[model samples]
Target: MSVDSDIISTLTQRAKQRPRRIILPEHGDERVLQAVCRLASNGAVVPVLLDAPTTDTATIPDNVEIFSRRSDAAQWRDRAAAELFARRAAKGTTAEQARASLDNPLLLAALLVGLGYVDGGVAGSVATTADVLRAGLHGVGLADDAHQVSSFFLMALADGRLLSYGDCGVIPDPDAEALADIAIATAAGHQRLTGAEPRVALLSFSTRGSAQHSKVDKVREAFDIVRRRQPSLRVDGELQFDAAFDPIVAQKKAPNSAVAGAANVFIFPDLDAGNIAYKITQRIGGAKALGPLLQGFARPWMDLSRGCSADDIADVAVIASLLGD
Candidate 1:
């Protein structure tokens, strides 16, 4: 079993109720175009393509809106530039620089979302992770309560259970405070997307007092911060993967913890661990990793795996449409 098919079906139905206008900056990419077709066909979103498909123009759907580079600038440049400057002026950005940056496809897509020309933006099939995240940070900005941008993968297990693995694709080496922030952001996102109460576990190489190291100490400290800051949040930490996910191991290891045998959200100690874990689950364990879905942004902007298929893009867009709700 993969992600509950019902969850995707439900989200697509919700998206159709109030279809979001989602801009695809890499419209020329075949995978992006295919995903756009899927989204348009389902009425899940109003697919806005930055540029017409170069090779598959004949396959483009009737409802898909394709904009040339010149046309996009002609239509939205003034508004996008003004919005960009307004958001960046405090950092001493000049109008000239703002206008120049708006010419960038990714930046313009994000700016369109920020300015409300569109509801969200999805790219990265043809862009690097850094490029995708930078556009979002500069254009959509960070959420008020969030310290910085972080990410989460919606891991759909073989047992048809959904879990969140966070800070997997961003924030290379977050400190304890940052880790706490990632956990909070991820937990909130998990609730919003899945409509399930999050039971968060901060994963480390040790379970409770089984090991002693600065890394273990960091996990403990972050766990404390999360609990103290959000007293109502159900969370635990210094848990190894086994203790976090397996009931038998949890009972033998960190017993009496609310999140111990049933963690729906896993916060990693670092990007290295988080990235490795998610990939291993997807490849070796046959889990469906729906994202590296971006979190902590004011407006919804998502990154795609460079290796993602068209189906992956469409699935991520459906989730992005539900973000910022």
Candidate 2:
């Protein structure tokens, strides 16, 4: 399905009102360069290009600031190295290892973010998800309140509705507590990003007491934990996909559920289910999946799909900028 243009427009408008300085680190990729130009031209952000080739200056917009490791290395290297060493000192990372890591563009962009050189950053177009996330964790670190980092997709349906699917790209097998945290974080993120009230659904193979298994029990336990943690949040769980999505099915399967048939945030039981569900929704169901956005971090840093287009990178940069608000 095509993306909901209204969502992008709204986000773009919001970002333009307060253009953020966002770093794009994949300088070698044409797609990333294209996105940087778009962001600069639109005035939606101050796009910072890391290690961009000087030969490409004519193609690069004037508003885009080029960060060169060759000439600018002396200014940031020592400071970045010191910060990295401090953060990873417990892991036996030597000062030399920390200094050498600054050469990596992804880690350098993340360190710039940690050092407040930019509002946030977007990467992963030419990098693996593992590498992108590792840079974010080692450089930016997690929020004080966050126990673990998680990811979520901003799914824009063909019908012009936006939904959130969580832990699709991180945490392979979250237990009950972790699952609950994912739900809470995704719900909060949904509200923040979309300006819509969050109705969360903990997805399962069974709806209520229709069937029983350890997996079903885990969903149920997660539901309880979410309730205990955020009593004011509208949430229900142990619901089949149909029951959670279709009002007709919800009426028959879980009539009294607070979030049945109206959920905007969906928490999958594990990475396998979340990943498969999002791909199916994007491929067969014709929805546009805008993320795999990293959350629960101290600051905003995003992970783009390796196969993403220039438009996808531009849109994610806007989203990352807005998350900084």
| Candidate maximizing TM-score | 2
Candidate 2 per-residue lDDT over residues 34-73, each given as its tens digit: 8998999999999998766546668987778877634766
What TM-score goes with each of the models?
Answer: 0.90, 0.92
Clashes of 1: 0
RMSD of 1: 2.6
Off by over 4 Å in 2: 1-4, 69-75
For residue 229, model 1's alpha carbon misses the true position, in angstroms, by 2.5
Task: Give the whole-model CA lDDT for all candidates, comma-separated.
Answer: 0.88, 0.89
Q: Which candidate is the best by lDDT?
A: 2
Per-residue CA lDDT of model 1 for 141-230, tens digit only, reads 888888999999888778778899999988999999999999999999888777899999999999988999999999999999999999
